[model samples]
Target: MARAFIGLGSNLAQPAAQIQAALHAMTQLADTQLIAQSSLYGSKPMGPQDQPDYVNAVVALQTSLTPHQLLDALQRIELEHGRVRKAERWGPRTLDLDILLFDDLQFSDERLTIPHYGMRQREFVIYPLLEIAPQLVLPDGTPLSDLQHTCDVNGLIRLSAQ
Candidate 1:
């Protein structure tokens, strides 16, 4: 099985519940086993300040599914949770799931990107990631520890685990 990390977030429709529900759904994915999961964190929206703050967390999974297969499953989870794709980038949504890493591999396609495009700089992603994988090394050889000092938590607050 390939080990992977997925970042989850929501800022609409009772976001904490949305995140909790997504976690449950992930555990049910065929050929997948939920591994470690971080406690939820609350943070400001990455795009327009007008949107509500988001609740975020990261989860580790061991799965037999290929990367695209995993992405397809994750997108299905988002849609099941009422996600909508909009032209507006980072607009508020009921759920957002991204493939942050997959067994130290690096590749990108129209449908997915490994290491996620912008994870290093996002406090919401960084802290929760750190909580679960303290010794993680990026596909580029950067230590996850090295990112902690540089990325400001920026009012990011840890919430209780569900």
Candidate 2:
């Protein structure tokens, strides 16, 4: 199995509820095991600050799925939750699942990028990530804790956990 980290977030229509629902759906994926999850963190929206605050968390999982397969699954979950990628980048959404890291794999394709291009630049992603895996490193060995310090997010706070 391949170990992976997924960043979860929601900012519309009961944000916390959507995150919990997505987690449940993830658990149901065949050949995928939800390993450890970080405590929830609330933070101001990263882009277009005019939107609602977001509830974010990180989940570590063991999955037999390939990178593309995992991406497909995440997109399905978003669709189930009524996610609409209309306008306003970083605008509010029902559910947003990002593949933060998939083992040490690295790739940049037209559709996706592993070790997510922005994982090292978001406090909302790094804070909860540090909670569950502080020593977690990218292929380049950058520590999660160190990355949290440089993100420019506002008002990041722990909310709850599973």
Candidate 3:
């Protein structure tokens, strides 16, 4: 099974409950196992100041499913949790599940991107990921630890221990 990292976020509804519920749902995925997950974090919205701060976390999964298959499964999970699509980028949502990294795979297409397109610059993604995988190195050989100092925690705060 390839180990993959999935990022979860929510700023709408009861976000912490949404995060925990998503964690449970992940364990039910066929051919997938939720190995580890980080604590909930509160962060300012990436796109607009008008929305509520988001609760975010990262999960590690060992899955036999391919990247695209995993993406499809994650999307399904999001939909089940009441996610809604919008034309506005970074608009608030009930759930946002992203494929942050899939083994050592480096890939992208119209549907998805691995080593997620924006992970490097987002403190909400970087900090929690460090908590779960401190020694992680991206597929391109960039050490995850090296980026921690680059992204300030100015707007990010740990909301829970687990």
What lDDT tens digits, residue by residue, belong to model 1 across residues 1-162? 999999999999999999999999999999999999999999999879999999999999999999999999999999999999999998999999999999988998888889899999999999999999999999899999999999998999998864
Clashing pairs in 3: none
Ranking by lDDT: 1, 3, 2
Taking the tens digit of each residue's C-alpha lDDT, what string does model 2 give over 34-59? 99998888988876878899999999
Which of 2 and 3 is ahead in lDDT?
Answer: 3
Please report, as a residue range, the 10-residue window in candidate 2 with the lowest summed lDDT.
145-154
> TM-score, each model?
0.98, 0.95, 0.98
Please give the CA lDDT of all the candidate structures.
0.95, 0.90, 0.94
Which 10-residue window of candidate 1 scores lowest in summed lDDT?
153-162
Q: Which residue window of length 10 is worst by lDDT in model 3?
A: 149-158
What is the lDDT, from 0 to 100, of the residue 77 in candidate 1?
A: 98
Superposed on all Cα atoms, the candidates' RMSDs to the truth, in angstroms, are: 0.9, 1.2, 0.7
Off by over 4 Å in 2: none
How many clashes does each candidate structure show, in the order listed?
Answer: 0, 0, 0
Off by over 4 Å in 1: none
RMSD of 1: 0.9
Residue-pair clashes, model 3: 0
